[model samples]
Target: MLEAIRERYIFNKCQVIILDDDGIITLSDDHLFEVPNAQPIENVHPFFETIRHLFDDKNEEHVFHCIHLEIGDVIGNYNVIFNSGNKEQNPFLVLYDFTENCNYIQTIVQRRNESVIALEFEQIQAQRLQAEQVFKNKLIATISHDLRTPLTSIAGFAELLQKQQGTPQGANYVQLISQSATVIKDILDNLLGLAKLEAGVAETQLKKLHLPELTDYLEAIYAPKMQQKGLQFSLKKSAPKNAFIADTTRILQVIINLVDNAVKFTEKGSIQVFLSVLAEAATEPILQITVIDTGIGFPQEATEKIGSFQRFHSTDVEGSGLGLSIVQGVVKHLQGKLDIQSAPDKGTTVWVEIPIQYAAETATAVQTNSDASITLAPLKIIVADDNDVNILLFQQMLAEQENVQVIAVNDGNTVLDELQKQPVDAVFLDVHMDGLDGITTAKLIKSNKLTKHIPLVAFTATNSAEELDMLQKAGMSLTLGKPFTQQQLLQVLQQISATK
Candidate 1:
């Protein structure tokens, strides 16, 4: 009976032993047991005498005992039990060998523990890396902020001093100061640009534009800056040229950055920018712009992250490390490609390409023959603004203009009072006001039939096409975004007063 039950219960490689009530061995097949062998059932035979007497007094005689052992190669794990038969045949002892089964459980437990440890280790490493990246970013941000503030003050003070004062030394100092400002601007731009590229906002603007016109404008802006740096800059077109199309602004920014970097990094070197037509007879046309510079080239290792953020020259060539990152993003956004070839002491070349279609130039010129600039009697222009700096910048900008006088006010009610007392030619109103907000003031001014003819130019910082269009439909004759150049201000102001 014991053997049948043990055989059914012990599925793994195991054996069992059985014994009769007199401490006699009845069956033996405990070879699978791995524990140290003892004095057999004979050693426990004496202890049974003490408990058997108590069982007999209660009309229940102890018949047999069984011992389970985990032996052999497996370590010590065992159990023992005693049984007494009532109406059945004499009781017997049974032993179950559980060493092999115990071994399997231990193996599984160890493997589970190992897997858990590995997972925990991976999690810890990932967390450490993430923390380090954040710390590095914050550190860079702090460095950028600290560097730009003093630079801004230096640039502004130098500019102001140069415009008002004169001396041979002062003129030299002014040129040096302007050079310093450019360097600072480059650093700030790189830092902020890298930050933006890392933030994943660079390649998102998928705007398209004509390549030739865009290049012409950028070349014009940077050509003077490059000349100041003692570098010759030129642009070229490849054979089979066509109208170029792609992510217009981003691509332009990339090429511009590459050219700027080349100028800043090279001394007495020529920087040539050319568009390459790389269309296979069977594939889509690809446009490649290669920026070639005859400068001290880059190290093999350093060239890989040329367009990455916060990276700059090892020397004091001052850069914020964002130009390359922005370039990379632009290339990615255009669904094009970027490649670099450089070696120490040799010139470097960066090749960028984008898949695009081109448009041919039309022969007709812009038809507004009414001389783009027409002079008008500077009327009494009422200026509404919440910012004192803006008011000052605007007032200073218009101070030297012909026949112009500006009346500045801070509040909406003040605007009305000033307007009612004086006959004004136009209202230069700020859309963001403390009271009688811009829209409300504009609506009130429009409602009064007497003031309806006064053209209102909204001075806002949002020149987004949508915002400008909306404000125009809402009775704003002109929208001039903030931080505009002197020329832009003059143009908008002229347009408003042109009709009057």
Candidate 2:
């Protein structure tokens, strides 16, 4: 039984020491000497120092529990109990070492604390980046509007001058003015697009697009220019259907940049655009668009740097190379694929494949028409814009219509007052106006029973996605950007008329 008790005592890692007038009168075992980190009883240095105060008051009994001390050179965690009696009686101390266990627990707590700090830091960084992106998007929108407003007046008057001028020299000057405005607009678009993409805020907004109409629009834009350069341009579609769901703006941007590049490089050869559907079933279809041009082709090395802003044949070509870079970024964001095939002196072919869903209702083919041949029904329109030039441009664009009447206002308050005075067929509003903004005016118009039936159009210079969404929510059914031509305005009028 005694041997069993001794074995259990050592296993429990317990030790006891008795102290008298001479100190260390007796020890239960040699466990303290056996412990590697503990001081020998003969030294009585740290251990005795740790409990000496308890015995100072000899007349009163004292007990110390769970006391930790430096045993030798190593600081260790320990639970110690001490009892002191009168001076003539003995004092006893009990020790239970827990240094290893406490160290392991301390390490775990330190790691957990570090992990919490790291997570908090990451959250803060993410929030900061998100805030910065919002500010950047707003700034881009403002800058675009400010720059494009004057450009719109410049281009609009240039078009008017080109029509009024009879001499070939005067027409040539007007054409240069118009072309310069267009080039400036293109540069602005490329810079804004690149900025958005680099900031990772180039969002995708999906909508049903009529493929045939899109192609027709592109042809109308580039055909005349290509003809002036003595180059052939044609757009073809071999799709099973005419409608697909995608980001309409992004799709237009991609195709426009590709065709523009083709037109810029191709000195004499033809530029052809093809749109086709690639799929095994109608439920999940992939739209493939290919742009082939017999242009001054680039080297194979240039093909490898599609997403980068690396200019090709820079010695002869005049471009920042941001066009193709914007195209690549938009394609990637849409989870599509882009391929370029080219060789020196050989024409280049660029193709993009995007997964899409066919619209629920397929649209019929749109018959293309010249702007001069189109006309609108007799209608009274209210136009609101802060800029007098924009208002004047609108009046001139509508002057050709036989019975169309345009009532112009410089602010949204006047627009509202006009609506209150008379019934109009449509309301055209610039998004930013003095006194009352266009968005609030739109909401008021939409909410009122008297004016809610009229078609609302946002003809503004700001075209940011966030602002567009705001305009839509405020009940604008259609949005046309500034620097628009007579044809575009007529198209918007027709659509509004048709909807009504």
Estimate TM-scores for all models: 0.55, 0.53
Q: Clash pairs of candidate 2?
A: none
lDDT assessment of candidate 2: 0.75
Q: Over the stretch 1-500, how does candidate 2's per-residue lDDT look in tens digits?
A: 98788677654566666666444445455354333223334365465665565666665544444445564554556666666756566766667767677789789989999999999999999998987676466555644664576577677767777677887766776776777677677767776776687678887776776777788898789989999999988899877644667777888888988898898788998999998776566357887889999988887767876634332222222342456767877777777888889876788999898777666554323345664666567788999999999999999998888667999999999999999898899999988888798888999999999888888999877657788888999999898888798888988888776665
Which parts of model 2 are misplaced by more than 4 Å?
1-166, 185-319, 339-374, 419-423, 446-454, 461-469, 494-500
What lDDT does candidate 1 reach at residue 251?
A: 66
Q: Candidate 2: minimum summed lDDT over ten consecutive residues — where?
A: 311-320
lDDT of 2 at 254: 86
RMSD of each candidate? 14.5, 13.7
Model 1: residues with Cα > 4 Å off, grouped in runs: 1-235, 239-249, 267-272, 278-285, 294-320, 342-347, 360-372, 431-454, 463-477
lDDT of 1 by residue, 1-500 (tens): 98877567663444444444454446655544422233345444344345443323222433332233323344443333344434454444333444456668779999999999999999999998987687577557656665676587677768777666787767776776666666675565555555555565543433334456666886888788788888888887664644444555666777777886687667877999987666566776777889998988777666665444223332222352445556776576567777788886688899887776543344122223344554656678888998888889889988788678889988678888987898888787788888777767877788888887888888886534566676776677777766465677777777766777
